[model samples]
Target: MITDPARLLVYESDGLTAYRTAPRAVVLPATTEEVVAVMKLLHAEGIPVVPRGAGTGLSGGALASPGAVILGTSRMNRILSLDPENRLARLQPGVVNTRLSDAARPHGLYYAPDPSSQTTCTIGGNVAENSGGPHCLKYGVTSRYVVGLTVVLADGEVVVLGGAGADPY
Candidate 1:
């Protein structure tokens, strides 16, 4: 069983302070295989699932339900790759918003979008809602940065969204 004294409560309320539930179990899977396995298990039981990142959500999107599986990706943070020539940075979904930009600082490049919760919001959640920021009008939103996504459905079916190229959708 997943354990973390405050995991449950934090799941319910991260970004939004008023509405919170915290979760019964909080899993931090470091790889795609682990994420798929847990999702498949939870899906088999037909349980509610809430995928979370930095817990800095303000829209109550990360709040947990009565009987839900809260998947926090904080532990999966990592920088997978970086291409200086192409001016691109590849990182895990759990990577922090500021972390990405911080890494890009010396390269004379940076992530275009800078949300208020950049310091705490995870890249996973940013991908979920296709986040936006003040510079999006010109720099574009999170959707522009994501070249692809490795997603696992409820039934343990893994799917790859987008591939290397110009099409990010």
Candidate 2:
């Protein structure tokens, strides 16, 4: 957790610099369990949580509200699994977008969503924004490539949505 005003300034705004709001604090959890615990505590106290990923969103979606805590996913970066044969990748929310393609390149595969900020933006942010670049006209957007999501609700309830083999309903 970051409470110092100086440190907090770094998270005051994302790529969209037009708007800025200093959060009460910032918490960067490094694991799923950690995120759940933080959410549980915040929920009990009635504090709002603003999820942020790499702070590169131009849509202003990552902006923190007054008295809210910035839940940054930057520390939870890792490629948990990459299955080239199955064309599936299990990654931590903080994994940078380009990193996924670089990893898959060895297997002659790549993550298709190529947002302009792909070099610095995290995949989680891309998912939230449904971001895309020039390639989207041909390959579609982020939602098309996303098959599953492990989400932690505001109340701290963890749920798995969709799956690798499940039909899109």
Candidate 3:
């Protein structure tokens, strides 16, 4: 948790500089358990949580509301699994967009979404924004590539939605 004002300044706004809000604090959780614990505590206290990826979103979706806690996923970065045979990957939300492609390149496969900020932006942010870039003209948006999601709801209930061969509902 980051309560120091100086450190908190870095999270005041994302790529969208027009708007800024100082969160009450910032919490960077490095694992699913950590995230769940944080969410549970915040939910029990009636506090709001604003999820943040790499802070590269131009949509300002990561802006923290007053008294909200910035739940940053930066520390949870890792490419959990990559299977060239099935053309599948299991990655932590904080994995940078380009990193996925780089990892896949050796297998002659690449993640299709190529947003301008791909070098710095996160896959999690892309999912949230349904982001698309130059390649989208042919490959479509982020939704087309997403296979599954493990989401922590507002009340701290964890839900797994979609999967490799299952319908996304």
lDDT of 1 by residue, 68-88 (tens): 878878888998887767777
The lDDT of each candidate is: 0.80, 0.93, 0.91
Task: Residues 43-154, candidate 2: write the lDDT tens digits.
Answer: 9999999999988888889999999999999998999999999899999899999999999999999989898889999988988999888999998888888889999999
Give RMSD to native, each candidate: 1.9, 1.0, 1.3
Name every residue pair that clashes in candidate 2. none
Question: How many steric clashes between backbone atoms does each model show?
Answer: 5, 0, 0
How well does candidate 3 score on lDDT at residue 132? 94
Candidate 3 lDDT by residue in tens digits, 80-130? 999899888998899999999999999999989998899998988889899
Cα displacement (angstroms), candidate 1, residue 122, comes to 1.4
Query: TM per model?
Result: 0.90, 0.97, 0.96
Model 2 poorest ten-residue lDDT run: 160-169
Deviation of model 1 at 26, angstroms: 1.2
The numbered model that scores best in lDDT is: 2
**Global lDDT of model 3:** 0.91
Which predicted model would earn the best TM-score? 2
Summed over model 2, clashes come to: 0
